[model samples]
Target: MTTTSLPIVSTCGTTGCSYNHDSDCHAGAITVTQGCGTYVDVAGEAGIDTRAQVGACHRSECVHNTALECGADSVAIGPSGGVADCLTFATA
Candidate 1:
């Protein structure tokens, strides 16, 4: 099923990230890491827009992931390993 919207990008939710703003990501693309880059802190995540699309993802085992890229229309990112991470990651 389609996840992201047309233009609005599902930004990251990671705090202290260079691309994170009000719990939203503002990067052209993002790379999801294993372990430390998964899970969405809904409580911590803010300003999340469902109309965002996933530019690129690295969760190989994610159901919405394909070849290190996100198949989901959009994604949510957050803090992981001191970096912005994908919050929409789900096991395949």
Candidate 2:
């Protein structure tokens, strides 16, 4: 099988996360975007483009967080308790 390197999974620091396997995201796909729990369409702040490119994550408590980007090969989102949380969040 051929693999494309477009979307890379960010390392998850949430041990409570399901997709987190030894600080690595095995979901193979993840969504990266700003704004959590609620909408923040405030003025002054530039609007961010929300796309599922497994690009970067907004989670700060994650270990694999570098410049807000995921380092995993890929990650899986959804089936969350509420918002689309990183299934690979492990605590430091």
Candidate 3:
């Protein structure tokens, strides 16, 4: 038998995001598109202490995306205009 862990959010630089605290994401799960689709602009907390994992990825061009899911060991997010972008994304 084998087990694998979901790709976790290793770091986040979107300070304006509600789920971001000290460059860490507490959103539980995040969606990756050209930017983070799960990003929230409000100033608050997700009320969760756990780090985020890639729930779904919409960038089929990203090498780390396997069947709309992140297959990397981990992922990083950063601010992009008013949203968050997947910094770990690479062209397939």
Question: Tell me, what's the RMSD of every candidate?
Answer: 7.2, 11.2, 2.4
Which one wins by TM-score: 1 or 3? 3
The candidate, 1 or 3, that scores higher on lDDT is 3
Query: After superposition, which runs of candidate 2 have C-alpha atoms over 4 Å from their true positions?
Result: 1-52
Each model's total of backbone clashes? 12, 12, 0
Encode model 1's per-residue lDDT on 1-92: one tens digit a residue: 34333223455555554445655564444445663233334544333433334544556788987666666656655554555555566784
Instruction: State each model's CA lDDT, in order.
Output: 0.52, 0.46, 0.84
Candidate 3 lDDT score relative to the true structure: 0.84
Per-residue lDDT of candidate 3, residues 22-89 (tens digit): 89999878888789988887756773888988888999988887778788899999975546889998
Model 3 residue runs over 4 Å out of place are 1-4, 80-82
The TM-score leader among the candidates is 3
Model 1 poorest 10 in a row by lDDT: 1-10
Q: For residue 86, give model 3's deviation from the true position in Å.
A: 0.2
lDDT of 1: 0.52
